[model samples]
Target: MLEHRPVVIDRTGADIHDEARRIRAHGPVAPVELPGGVRAWSITGHAAARLALSDHRFSKDPRRHWTAYVDGRIGDDFPLIGWVLMDNLTTTHGADHTRLRRLTAKAFTPRRVAAMRPGIERLVAELLDELAAVPPGRPVDLKAAFAHPLPSRVICDLFGIPPEARARMLRGGETNVDTTLTPEESAANVEQWHREMYEFVESRRRTPGDDLTTDLIAAKEDGSQLSDSELVGTLHLLLATGTEPVMNLITNAVAALLTHPEQLALVRSGEVDLREAVEETLRVQAPVAHLPFRFTTEEVVLGGVTIPRGEPVLINFAGIGRDPALHGADADRFDVARKDKEHLSFGHGIYRCIGAPLAWLETEIALTALFDRFPRLTLAVDEGELEPQATFIMNGRLTLPVLTEPAVVGSPSDVTV
Candidate 1:
């Protein structure tokens, strides 16, 4: 047999899809190198990714199963250490996973998410009003002005994070997922994040509020439901997941629609709804592109390759989202009306994203209200000029500049869904 070489993934996230294409060419299960010269297997095909995500042999508890991590080869300076070492629902296995997920799900129930729709709609309207006030000729960075803040505000309110500390929380969340950080930067970020999270939890304990943080605090104090460390870790996970992913989803959908005018016309003519557009966007550009560090419990054969026991694996969501075998030859093309709009962007099986319902509601409302307010909105710069976010773990533009033109002449109430 020829010698196996690991494909080194780009840490800067310059062109993740291009990297994904190369990895897929290697096979469904491909050896890959992470930022710290760390070796892992990537699940590059749709079927393979789904199987790996739901397979019992794949353990999310890296502390127990990941040889490098357990043996001290992976350290604090590793760029992805923060993500791989978390104690939240994302990294737990078996009964621990079940318990954490159950507690987290209570805050994201369909009824709770649906109840927030009116508040979300109101927030969207307020944001649109602010965007409308910008001079017609000046280009606006939609990612900054609209996309990022909408989800930030929604999640902060949901968790009852004090307004004074929201900015630090947002910064810490961004730093946690950025793969391009230097060893010093990564270590500092992890330390800062833990400190801030602990402080926030303590504040919640001192003065309970009507929010998810308070509920989680209560569970932590219930003497068996949640440990103190788990409480902080869970909050950290919720803050990170609840903000950045939804921000990217809105920006990606808007970018997709702006680039594909025909698809935009379909939505404008009522031929396709905004929800369909959102789904298509998710299929093409998943928010979390490459989730980190699931290890194998035993030798497992997949796609004609065997991952040895204790070997690490990554779910390549970016590659799987556009897998040609499942999505057909034109998988890359953005089509709002495409049939069989199936995707594992939120994930699969027990690890499915608990905040998915809230994400969907936020995106749908934000998109509808945005298009309604600025019917003639178009990209201020060429699509090629857009810059990808600095992290391989998350997929989004660093900035999306657009011109909001021919503004609708109406009050907030005049804008109808």
Candidate 2:
């Protein structure tokens, strides 16, 4: 038996990196208490995280495997219930997970993701144009103005959601990912999200277009096994997955580059590839802080600790990235040129993020365009003044206030250059 008092993860202050380091000190698998005193285990070691994620004994279906959830201890009223109870590829396992993933994988193929580069470049250019319009020396909140909207717009276009409907989706999506919401608010937000997604599905069905949503509907009509719940759930997953993580990817990558001028200079000067920069950012500052809600099917020992069956397991991606056992002593340092850059930022095995290719494309394009337009961009406030989102699952700044020198128009039409 470990200490009676578990580390409460909810009170992580301004520096979450330090918090992750502190959790890692408690051993690879440490007991933790989330807000409202929800007891769980946190996998804070790199090797242990990989084992937990890939281990078949650890089921992703919380409804089936989580004893606390089955016994009502992890109720719907729980703040994090909205994430765990999701009925899409995230929560499904076995043949069901394989089937659902197959339906969605067609849309994210390398060829398809590559084909989106032109559109993504156009969107990035447009957003950068808007950013350039901001007055010099005036701090613009990049999260709201650029980082957030770039991916949102791309996702909306992909799903054939109208510009008008995006406002509703954005509003509900914001509320859903916000971990600071009260249980009541969280439930309400999730219901609202469901309603919006249902409407989106219905709208797509009524007016099918040359879009992924319409494609999914067609697949269902042509005897694909996607049910109503899966359809709505997948749409919600796409939006949530697309917007929040990708938004943070862009914002976090920019923040990383801004804070690490030496590394940023390499990317800016073409010495280091932007892809490398993005990879480094993903390793050091993964968009999602915690991979919440994996449940053990049977008692399992990891890193010298026994996790009882049916306990909720959280993979601390934040901690794993900095584990010295994997990355040596300089693991905490941000190095775009690091030789060993393996990380679980997008996860591992069959459940790795299906949208990772698109995300990488989006981030690379957005970063390349933004810097090309404003090569001298810098944070407007002290780095310490920037605040991360209050949520433990999502790791990003609430706002990235940045200033740049006046933009000069001398770019070729091709943003990929």
Candidate 3:
């Protein structure tokens, strides 16, 4: 173990980028303390992060590989217990992981995601129409009214969640990523989320629908392909992962474009596509900032530091995205026209996010339609005054207040796509 004291991470989302810079100063593989006093190593360099993510020595299953959790140092009351303990595809290994991923991939096929484009465009149109109705001078929260609902509604519709049940599920997702919650509150939130997922699964099992949930249930009934626990856990994972990160992607992209008027002009003047803006936002303001709990299967040397077996590791997506070595000195700046816009915001290796295609399609459509409709949209407050989301795991604004300039709603012919 390293002799120096571990750097305690900020539970509050504020200063995460600053914190990442501080962690990088400690070295690529730096000792860090998670919320609730859980000790871990954070991978801060782009190459080191890629190695850790793809290396076979690093295992995602905490129940088997995490010494602290196995020996009871991390209890059920730990605020982040739910993240590591879940039995979804994210926490499986080898054959189990392959099997789970194979089963889950059916729902996210290229055809299925492509088919969602028309519906997604319609949803974007409806949202833009609603934003156009807001009084010109009054500030409207685009994050809540636009970003949050688009993905939430898409996921709910994809899973066949009833309109009445969606609000509760969305609230549960908010709780899942909130690292600032108390032990008691976190435990209770986990319990409630599990209960809600169980009910959802049971409801779908009883009344089959033309949705992914129904498809998954059918697989579960065929030759023991999935267990009850796995079924509920998969749904829970899908609902949470499907909504929150995509929500942040849209909001963060809009925030980036609004603050960086030069970048916005690039998109508006046809110098660059909206996709470039989305890619730049993903690089600078990664939606999932710091992912949790990849444990060492054996002693491994990373960045000249020795990590013992069973030690937990965190992949700092935020830090790696802005690494000067990879993205040059201006990595921190948001530039849509940058030649190299590569990022691990959707992750890497076999564990790379499966919903990435859907997320990209949703965000591109959302941004294009948004700019096309409200050509004069501007931030209601100074960029510095916008509040960050309360959790370190999710990089986004709590609210993006914007003046939607209803009078300037542009026609389709004016779109810069």
lDDT: which is higher, 2 or 3?
3
In candidate 1, which residue ranges exceed 4 Å CA deviation?
A: 1-3, 220-223, 406-417
Expressed as tens digits, the lDDT of each residue in 1-417 for candidate 1 is 242689898998999999998898888789999988988998878898888888888988888888878999888877788877578886888777778888878889899899999999999999999988876656789999999999999999999998999999878889978888897887788788889988988988899999999988776322457777888889888988999999999999999999999999999999998788888899999988988878998999997688889988999888888899899888878899998778899999887899999999999889988998898899888999999999888999999988887433552222111
Q: Which pairs of residues collide in model 1?
A: none
Give TM-scores for every candidate, taking all chains together and pairing residue i with residue i: 0.95, 0.93, 0.95
lDDT of 3 by residue, 1-417 (tens): 445678899998787899898888888889999888878998879888888878889988888889888898889888888787577886887777778888888889999999999999999999888988776666789988999899999999999999999999778778988888998888888889888888888888899999999998777423557777888878888888888999999999999988989889888999998888888899999998888878999999998788889998988888988999899889899999999998888888887899999999899899888888888998888899899889888888888988886324442222110
lDDT by residue (296-391, candidate 2, tens digit) is 889999988888899888888888888888999999999998988888999898878999989988887888778888888988878888888877
| TM value for model 3 | 0.95
> Which candidate, 1 or 2, has the higher lDDT?
1
Cα lDDT of all candidates, in order?
Answer: 0.87, 0.82, 0.86
- Poorest 10 consecutive residues by lDDT, candidate 3: 408-417
